[model samples]
Target: MNVLVLMLTVLNCLSKASERTFPRIVPSQLQFLEYTNLTVTCEGFFNDMIQWRVLRKDEKRNRRTSCNKNTDAFGACHIEALYPSDSGEYWCESDDKRRSERVQVTVTVTDVILESPVRPVTVGDHVTLRCIKRKKLKPSTKFDFYKDGVHVNTSSTGEMILHNISLSDQGLYKCNVSEKGFTKENLLQVKAVLLELPDRPVLEGENVTLFCRDKMAASNYTTFFYKDDEMIGNSSSGKLTLNKVFKTDEGVYKCQTSEDRESEEQWLAVRGGNSFSTSDVSGVTHFNMFYLSGLIALPVLLFVLVFIYKKYKGPPVTNEEDEAKYTALTKRDTSLYHELKPPNSTC
Candidate 1:
């Protein structure tokens, strides 16, 4: 009788202490970009007996019988194309009644999609842009490529190729397709490749020259250098020079040919004048130089002002009455000269 009672007690304790060994979905992101293929795997459990469920609103949808295919022994759910309606909490529940933690996923819908390579498009690369419906992959339909909203090319094969890509070919592209008497458009961005660069570890006060070349040789076109999207200089020789580099000169730099070909922005880092390079100072852009310089100077300026005030005003005033008056002056005026005025005097 005692053995039976102890066995029951131990079994109850074990049951109470046991938790779901696998409690999460792999690639556990709550939000996913639309049209992306997502493979959400329920990790930790080694059972093929696991079942996946997606809870949308108040309804429970089965993954095994739905649009997902079981990928492996752990019952990973794979969705080919995710749509907005697919947004919900997903989880895996084992046959033994162990339930994994639910993962919320949201899918967004868009009118068009630009299908391009993941890497930057370079010269000599035959880049192709295919516009497609975000939700479904349907039959090959006629499509047109538009640059800056103007029609450039039309193809019945649903693909437009930029052959022997050059700098002049870079622009904001959009693909348009007519379906069911309605036109759908999507945006595409093509970036130019870096052809040449100066030696690394650019030091302050040193001069450096950079050259930008297009994949194809097009004569009579001038190249313009840009720092943080602002045009710095133009050269017909495809060469741009940085004279007497300052800390302020470091920034994301790019070049565009007169043909309107823009190169990919690259970081130009300038270290202190004493050293050529430092790991901590690398990759910092000069875009915020003005703001950073003001921030650094403000505290030093305040310290100098305080020192001059203490030296000229005789012994330092420390009374509560004087402190209150000082605080009041500071609150009254935002400018340094106004704040430094005597408590009872007006400037």
Candidate 2:
């Protein structure tokens, strides 16, 4: 009984831990032009309890605030006109102290800006940086790319593409148009290792493969795979394949290289094969609840059926003595009826 309680407690914790809360940004970019609108919304199961909080660039503390005018009915906060003063870190915070990932936003009034991904890119990813100018540029315009204030490459299309980026590629990047001017420097972060898996939920009983690759293209290095902080396996090829994955196989997974470089941990969700619509981890929890309910209800159902049968159809005569007792009772009733019968008086 104690073991069962422990199992239930652990499963409940897993179920609750799987639900994620995060802030969603419209336009999905960290940098914005002055006077442009920005929208932020908290997304999760407890969105109603979440509120927008920001650490302004000039301020040392974070404070809760609403949109410039009013928050919409859907809980989205809108900044109608962004200014350089609005540049800071923004995130969602719940009343109970739960916080989401913070996003750094920059608002600039420059004539040109560099367009890049807001999030860090994995090593070996092909990344493209575009130089956007407030005014249109000529088709034959020449753009110069710089990393950390050093000229790296030049492009004619007003964009620079870095093929198979490595750690050395991560630095402050800027672009200069031939006639326009230079844009503000933007930071490019490249991770050393990346663990690859399916972005969508995997179906139970399906085979899943996870690959861990070194951004530097190292040939011989042992890779270690972990699930929920527990080591599961290792390989020289930096790949791990799980055959016929079950709900129990679902958890947070990450990989590490021989040099101790680790990738970010990601959740692996497994859903019932028959239930494609239920995509979250709660689906597995529901299945577990149903299974447990069946286990607890089966015995009671059998007991109730036996009780109803005995209450209406009577009990079975399991022994000869019981059968004899039933026969004697019937015979005695018949004899008594005969004794109580009066002699035939009708003529």
Candidate 3:
């Protein structure tokens, strides 16, 4: 019974390890215009037991509901014709009560909404913001863009392309259409530097290379890396390669260029070195659960087998004749010892 309990405990741990804590959003953006379609997919090997979760804005309490009759085989929840009421926090949740990180979704009902990524864009990235009108507008309509209420650029295609975004470009942005009013302001964030690393969960003892990239800078700049606010290493190639990383290496990391331009701190999570397949669901895998379960069960099974063998195999049994012979030998040995004893010897 104890062995069975141990095995069960191991299985439970494996199940927890395989759980993914986030869902994937189609189109990869958080904000959308009203009446648009959005698909939230639960990605991972064990996503079959996962479902979509949303907290609508107008609701006084949290509510859980299924997709709008448009679920696919991939565990995706399709929300068609999203209205402003649909704007709220969204995430994925498993039946075991594990939840993914919540993402705030905003659905705007304005006649014009600026099309931009809700997520913060890295520095030196080329981003384009489009002025999307609810009603069909002329292709040649002139559009004006503003950064913090200051006119920056004008475009006839209704799209403003930002070349090599820098820290100075981070501000509130809104666009104006010909004769139409300005769209709602959206914040455009830019980082001075970006540390590029693997998208998957990093396992312990694996070699990881972090690349400090600054697309707008010259190639001759030096890059420095820090872990938990402590300087660890630096390189001229803007790359810091850590060989045989351990769990101790897991921490918040950041990089800076020679010009003191720094990037946003990112956390490095080092998992166990055990071999397991990971899924896109927040860097957790599913198939490795069985493999780890077998590892835990093998030793317990061996121990149980040895215990049973000892329990069934009792001590050696002796017949009556053999017991009498052993007794006679014992008496003879005692008589021989008495005969060999010295006269002066005391008991």
Candidate 4:
């Protein structure tokens, strides 16, 4: 019996590894603007139990789910709500009685643009359009990107991203998002930038990083940035970066190489300021909030205390005034004293 159990364990391990070996099925094209229908198929020879999951690029872990068994040999499972976060790899387990293999499937929702023109955009321009996904993908299904009707790029983690593009990237742009196997599309106009920062831009108060990139690409074409027709200090590394920037750094900026080839002038504004006021109005307002109740209740409390004292201890009498009144009464009684005098003294 022990030997038989050991054999079963080995067989189970082998089957598990095999069931995990295959990739999940994905569609070549998806139809969006309709109800979601994301059907993911796995290679199977196993029992009815199928494992499924969704994941995000930023997440280090995956969420798990149990799948409903397909009644046919297709071994497919369907999920609904194909939102932006539902874009991820899906795996299914297929156990063939004695051996098993896993299938890994990639799910894609159709993200095609519904509102973009069929022309390539020029440089140094911006475009705006609305994106709509009809498929009922989960809130996690991200939009896929494309150019010229071909898969040129992707944004699986976010809904939108700026291209910071050049003339070389001129093509039609669209979006693809899917859910449950249903697809969505969003049309967009792609434009090239003739004058701008090519890489990530960092704006600083005292120190500014400046850049000027040409719309055309050539390894030998030197890229240079000029402010008021003056070149920056120097560059140990070829990147245009100014550390410890100042307000004086703000000015008209442009890029040029070979003196004749130049981009349009662009303005960069850098406002420099530092403050240490104990009396900023907004700050004071927040700081003095604690004193509001006490300040308001002070007069009312004084009035109440006076009323309470009058109720409990009667009215107050001044000792000096009372003494003066008693002295006057004694003076008036002095005549009686004189009448009763026994001829002793000058009454």
Q: Highest lDDT: which candidate?
A: 2
Please give, for residues 1-347, the per-residue lDDT of candidate 4 as tens digits. Answer: 34344444333433432122233434312222233446555432221233333211312246544343333333566656444344444544434222222222223334432333222345655543333543444564455666566765455453444445455555445555554332233333343223453121113444555454445545445666677678654322224766665656645565565424555444443422532122343454454554566777899999999889889996778999899999999998997888788986863
Error of 3 at 209 (Å): 3.7
- State how far residue 242 of model 3 sits from its true place (Å): 4.6
Off by over 4 Å in 2: 1-25, 40-77, 92-100, 136-142, 177-181, 201-211, 215-220, 225-253, 268-347
Candidate 3, residues 68-114, lDDT tens digits: the string is 35322225667778887777677655454545555566778766778
Give the per-residue lDDT of model 1 (tens digit) for 204-224: 889988888865446677888
Model with the higher lDDT, candidate 2 or 3: 2
User: Candidate 2 vs. truth: CA RMSD?
Assistant: 13.7
Over 202-278, each residue of candidate 2 has an lDDT whose tens digit, in order, gives 67889999999877656899999998789999999999999999988876688999987887666576766763333
lDDT against the true structure, per candidate, is 0.58, 0.71, 0.70, 0.45
Candidate 4 accuracy as lDDT: 0.45
Q: 162 in model 1: Cα distance from truth in Å?
A: 3.7
Q: In the order shown, what is each candidate's alpha-carbon RMSD?
A: 29.5, 13.7, 15.5, 25.3
lDDT for 125 in candidate 1 is 68
Q: Candidate 3: give the clashing pairs.
A: 21-100
Off by over 4 Å in 4: 1-146, 149-170, 174-223, 226-246, 251-269, 272-313, 316-344
Q: Is candidate 3 or candidate 4 better by lDDT?
A: 3
Clashing pairs in 1: 167-261
